[model samples]
Target: MSTLLSLNAQSRDADHMLEQALQQWGGERDLWIFGYGSLIWRPDFDFSERCSAHVHGWHRALKMWSTINRGTPQCPGLVFGMLSGGSCQGMVFRIPRDYGEAVMRKLWLREMPNAVYDPRWLPCKTLQGPVQALAFTLSRQSPHHTGELEPDEYRRIFSQARGIYGTTLDYAQATFDELQRLGIADKALQRLLSYADCDRSVESVAI
Candidate 1:
């Protein structure tokens, strides 16, 4: 996989921020990181192995709304949230302490570039036991946020928008495919495909 870099000034300064975080960790060899979304299938870093894990107090939801990719500015598409008081089943990868700085920098560049996320140390429940891991949560209070949308409005936005990568349908398909590959599924996301009002043949988002 390719390292994530900002294409413009508006992007979040991910590389710098991640380096700072790694420096704080001071190169702990036992460092492990968990990924649930795009990173689950597309991690660019070198890792020895990964296994199923779960994090409590957060659940992935399409909480972040964006018209930039899936809708117009007037109507944005939804993205994930590690909201409070829920649990998510995902995978965690262990990074060698020596490569911490580089791997952390790349991860921050990819996911935290927009400064829309707050990386918090959370406990990841692995087969061995609970391990401390840094998990990025979308800032619900950010001024740039579009707030939560009604399900109907969300459907409308998904039915429209085009992103930097491609159309909203493309976003949906990519997410669906990746999630299934991980053997994980969300009922909310599945429900979305059935409720969204778009031409499936042309503009449909996969379930």
Candidate 2:
């Protein structure tokens, strides 16, 4: 019980971090958020504008374990995380200054529950121009960073792991479908989806 309480306390510290970051903003202008994964399809927050944006020095990869929203501790699911390397093409959202605090609070609760992600302000290039946007990136040293895994491991997680939001397979499919609609092609994600579909077919045959 003490351990659980301590964990919860640590998670709440993310809220404090959010407050500190906001203080530095000075409420002078709009806030921009860069989304490379689920946020692309389900922002769940009000934004004044959004546009296709690119960020250098980092790329999106399914490198994090989702032990809450997409799966449990026993059967962890996979999620996207920004890692240092190539570039990533994603979406950047502009939140009105008046709404920045509220929207950021909601985002913090959604993404920083375990404080596993390191939120940073990154410069994103949009069709309009360059904008400094907040992005959640994962450190390679983090325990939740999956680095690399076997195809079978991914198949098992997609087939069997589920959580409050839904199955990991569904999450991956939604992200892939959304990216396709946006005219973005991700070959690695395509292969992952193929593995998931193959797993489902095998299960259907067994049933």
Candidate 3:
């Protein structure tokens, strides 16, 4: 992981980060973005097409604690991670070359606007072969970045946390649904959900 991964604080400069990205990926025509989180199911991009891609050294983990979404400010919520360790199978979207910059900008604005994410480029093995794609990692600088949390705490927030987006339950439901539909039931994700406080409801509703 690069130092950028350590930039999980809430005070990053969005414009500057975008400019750096533009420079890094400048002149690229068709763009492939690897999505392992909410993007796996709910892609907010207008893409020309999508294909499967495999990225190594990272798998989804519920390593992040958020006070604003799944959990309250005091209790906080938990979110998944593309943490380094194993490989992740996810979809890669092909965005138009001319619109790549704009589309990338939209992605950054949606995810990295707070500067809490360290966006980086990684090589994704796509149908076409290996291709570089944009991905975001949590910053170590973030006060909210918890390397580990108690199982009970993980469950309480996961069981009750909600946000402007929705409840933590909704998040789990969405991810489980998407992964199962894709026939990619990631074991790590299942284990994370297993730590949640609500089982009866999750057992019936988890897809």
Candidate 4:
């Protein structure tokens, strides 16, 4: 199938999900979204305020298979997902109440094209205070969740997997760079990038 068609087919019931979230939110205050990965650097939507935030019970992990954005079906790439356990430090964006629905629609289109994430209202702590923010988390049982992979397999996918956006290596690098710029430390991600970089260097020498 064509890329556009495939993306459309993979989309979840976004409108319904939005409605559910809205009902649960009660239109009481601004909408906050906790971004852990690409959203940290590439939040395509406008926001009223942004802050460094922390959320408990979920940690950033390169555990989700990307079939369309970062790789193909035959060579799936890994993307960052919020998995159960520990905590995560990231950015939280607040959308004004008037723009909440519109911003949410855009977010769903970008992040929820596939039904891999379980959207949840997570409590996040920022310097200003604590706020409940929307976060996309993955369940261990989900098919897209890659619990672990052999080193060779991981390197192969990282080096070779490319999708409509770009290579998985580039995506990982971008995330790592952004986190560093924000003074956030993620040793696991740094190690993964080191390995990928070494592999690429070896390939260049061989070539």
Candidate 5:
């Protein structure tokens, strides 16, 4: 159908654009990528080194609505969005200079399919020093971006939403667990996990 063809065309165009971004952002040395969410647990790429880094002015929150990976149109599940304020502690991935372009392109394909994130080579503070790392932060202007959501809305989505990737609870729980392992505590995620626990219990009784 025309829609399918359009999607394919968009993918191709995105690939081409990201290929260009790689060249521009990679710089003369190794490239660093900052990850705070799924990237922390599943960075499916080969990185030369990983460092615990911190970035100010952005904190991860469940502010993005997913219609595919974690939810559907009727009950969109929530996902992390790096919002402006506070600081975040997460892992930074370093890609070899020669492999920068290829890795950037792959990352773009994975994260930018929906164009919901604002990708930039941001400067992060790491123990080694400072590095300009590629980061995907939420864009407030995007339709998928929800600057804020009610507590009950989160409970509803985590309980009812399921997508191709898995259950919303699973996604939230995994992220919370990974953060704990990394010595980073996310209070908001912890609350979501508790809500998910309640949801599972309620489902159990119904079944």
Candidate 6:
């Protein structure tokens, strides 16, 4: 279909842009990626090793508006983003050097279709050691950025928002559960989980 081809082309273009961003910001060694959102729970990628990691000057917030995959433009869903602030705890994945470019392309297609996320290589402190990992963060200037929303606004959206990917609540719930399994407690996500109802979070397995 013409639409499919257009999407593929768009993905390629995004990958090209990401390559440029990394060229200026990435380190010169092993490829590591920092994931704090759904990628934390469902990293459909191949990596040699993964470990708990933390990055300073950034924290996760459900402040990005999803026009697709999770909601429509008229009634957008909220998604987690790495925002500038305090430190954040997340998962770091180490990819084999041979597969770095391939994985970067895949990641670009997945996370960089728009300017909502600014891809950058950030220093992540992993238990194994310190690693500079590529991360997708919120662009404060982007139209899709919501800064912060009240709990009721989050609950309203989580209850009704769904897209090709699934419900917004499912995404939040899965991330919360995954963090628990990793023994990494994110109090912020937990608060949203409470608003989203952690009691029935198991039903959010769809994400």
The number of the candidate with the highest TM-score is 4
lDDT string, candidate 2, 169-200, tens digits: 99988999999999888898899889988977
Better of 5 and 6 by lDDT: 6
All candidates' TM-scores? 0.77, 0.90, 0.85, 0.91, 0.86, 0.84
Which candidate order results from sorting by lDDT in descending order?
2, 4, 6, 5, 3, 1
Per-residue C-alpha lDDT of model 3 across residues 1-207, encoded as one tens digit per residue = 322422334337877787777777775567778788788887888998877888887766767766665667866666665667678888788887898998888888777756666677778887678878887766444665787767776677676787767777678768887888887768866766777635656777976
Tens digits of per-residue lDDT for model 5, 1-207: 000112234433655546546656645788888998889998979999998998887878778888888888987887777876788888899999888877877887788886667666666898899887777777576688876667777778876888889877788788888889888888867876777677778889999
**TM-score, cand. 4 vs. native:** 0.91
The global C-alpha lDDT for each of the candidates, from Candidate 1 onward, is: 0.66, 0.85, 0.73, 0.85, 0.77, 0.78
- Candidate 3 — which pairs collide? 6-140, 7-139, 8-139, 66-77, 70-161, 71-76, 71-77
Provide the lDDT at 137 for model 6: 76
lDDT tens string, model 1, 1-207? 111222256335665556545655678566777776666766888997788788877877666755454555665566565666678877888887877767887777666656777666677888888777767776557654556666666666666666665665566556667777777787767776655534464454454
Q: List, residue by residue over 87-134, the lDDT tens digit for candidate 4.
A: 899999999998887888789889877656778888899999998898
lDDT of model number 4: 0.85
TM-score of 5: 0.86
Residue ranges of candidate 4 with Cα displaced over 4 Å:
1-12
Worst 10 residues of 5 by lDDT: 1-10
Please state the error at residue 31 of candidate 5 in Å.
0.9
> Which regions in candidate 1 have their CA more than 4 angstroms from the true location?
1-20, 67-75, 197-207
Can you rank all candidates by TM-score, best first?
Answer: 4, 2, 5, 3, 6, 1
